[model samples]
Target: MTNSTAKEEILGRIRNAQKIAFSGKDLASSAGVVTGTPGEHFAVPRDYERTSDMPREEVISLADERIADYKADVRRCSAEPAEINEAVKKAVADAGAKIVGIPSGLDKAWVSGLDEGKGEIRVDEGLGVRDLDALDAIVTSSAVTCAETGTIFLDGSPACGRRALTLVPDVHICVVPADSVVYGIPESISRLRDADPTVPITMISGPSATSDIELNRVEGVHGPRTLMVIIAG
Candidate 1:
């Protein structure tokens, strides 16, 4: 079963145990609610809010703050093609990237300002891990983002490219459309319901990092060390 399913089952047991104690009911012995087989399924109530009514501006603002909290650089730009391109160009330059990967399906306008003079814009054509690792950075548009969690979801769309394209790169520059930003994970998942499940779904909260038992922090242990988020609204 999925992790979510396991969690709900465990919580159901806890709640049932609490109810039995509070109400002086012997349901556990009479109904065997807690003695079910390992794979027995328990229905879980999913009545929690799944969508947000927050304004678009607030959603984007909260995303910016949350993403920045992870120590990733966040920048906001107009949704216009020109402005996005300029913001992307500036970010590329700031990162001092000389070899940049532009995934397939990404809008040409986003990289219109980037040329050979600034860096090599390598178009992703099912590149392997080694090929991506050689690049200085990569730029791609995200499928959707959860503002509350600062999580960006890259469905294997042409625009987002293959999951490997972002994973192996040293730096990732993800362009997020403001309207594509949702308030929470449920809404974000709802946005991708129509996509093919076989296609990979990459959930990136921040640049990959971890701390040792000593609590010494390190970055880039698993994936890109630097993450630059460009929010285009």
Candidate 2:
């Protein structure tokens, strides 16, 4: 195996050994380490409830206001098939970005509608790390949306292929049907549970941003710089 591959294999073995040790198993054979040490509770806690001071309706109102702010310049329309093509074109044109789709997205006639003169358009499934680096933007369809927060959900369906495309690229253009827009996140939970539970669903509200340091705002640090939404009419 190559050096990188061999190193990764060794690292995986070490992680497995650590897991076995942390799970109260004897890992003397693997890592020459003993169990029942003082820092043995290496396991991460998964279940925890968050306490919020704001009441339910107040919280809902807050979310509603935030959604309104995000959707201010954003437009909406009735759910229709034709709007998909229109939205894709509009997002690409607006961003001045080239378009690239995943494997299943290749045959989409909407993709062919892109202007090659203005930007490059390609349909390829082999969008590995390197290929992803070359793309300017990714367009996808959502499984659902939250009208209360103007949030969009991408469940990595075949049409939505590789989650990174929606995340890694500088811009993400997601198309959602108006009918698919639910009242709130709670309403989305039911639909999500019915869909593939294992699918990595990304809930995005506006663009990637954070105010961690001194509460100062910064955008596109962890995800896309711009999140464009197209409400299919």
Candidate 3:
């Protein structure tokens, strides 16, 4: 009849309904609503294909196309180390990079072609944030790339380096092996897990860009403004 009484009635009804719904068992009991045993394994349906059936060459081509569509530069080079070095050299030269940061374990040969007078190469072992920002660009290797999404995955491997190295630099030149390009996200994840499940993964769709309320697109808000991918096959 009164507000207090009505509230009490509603609460009582809710309790009764819960008891009936739970078949008179305690609501907190695991058996009441949750019945799965601890540590029990259940078979999950994996009807989807782990990866697309496209051939390796086709996958790489699709990845290159998608990467270009994202407005990122894509360069193709022979799989040979020397050619890769030349490609890296050209990418840096085109960016007009005076100072470049590279991961500690990255192949020194990649930057071997860079002339000391034109550009300085700094290996990032444990560089400070400002140190990385001062560099003209950062060069690293990708663990895997997804052709479907035009995404690159970095798992902090020796070649990938720390996350900050990529975030602070204005230009990022990622060297991706053609074989590392996968058909889709599922295949990418599978490959990454097989590589190192515990390592952190960073996925880049494109150079960092954001749209404001008026739909004005601005680039390089949080990460590199320019992304160049060298697909070495």
Candidate 1 displacement at residue 50 in angstroms: 1.1
**Residue-by-residue lDDT tens digits, candidate 3, 1-233:** 99999999999999897877788555446455544566998566688878688888889899999989878999999889899999998999899898999999898888895657766888998999889989999889999999999999999888998889989999999999988899988889888875666666889988889999999989999999999999999
For model 2, the stretches where C-alpha displacement exceeds 4 angstroms are 1-73, 102-107
Model 2's lDDT to the true fold? 0.66
How do these models rank on TM-score, best leading? 3, 1, 2
Question: In candidate 1, what residue range of length 10 has the lowest lDDT sum?
Answer: 29-38
Q: Score each candidate by Cα lDDT.
A: 0.90, 0.66, 0.89
Report the number of the highest-TM-score candidate: 3
Which parts of model 1 have CA positions greater than 4 angstroms off?
1-44
Residue 113 alpha-carbon offset, candidate 2, angstroms: 1.2
Q: Sort every candidate by lDDT, greatest first.
A: 1, 3, 2
Candidate 2 or 1, higher lDDT = 1
- After TM-score superposition, the amount by which residue 81's alpha carbon in candidate 3 deviates from its true location, in angstroms, is 1.1
Cα RMSD (Å) between model 2 and the true structure?
11.9
Clashing pairs in 1: none
Q: What TM-score quantifies how close candidate 3 is to the native fold?
A: 0.83
What are the runs in model 3 whose C-alpha is more than 4 Å off? 1-39, 194-198
**Model 2 over residues 4-119: C-alpha lDDT tens digits?**
99999999999997888799965564676534456566655535432334444454444445545663225444455556676677778888786554436533654556756767
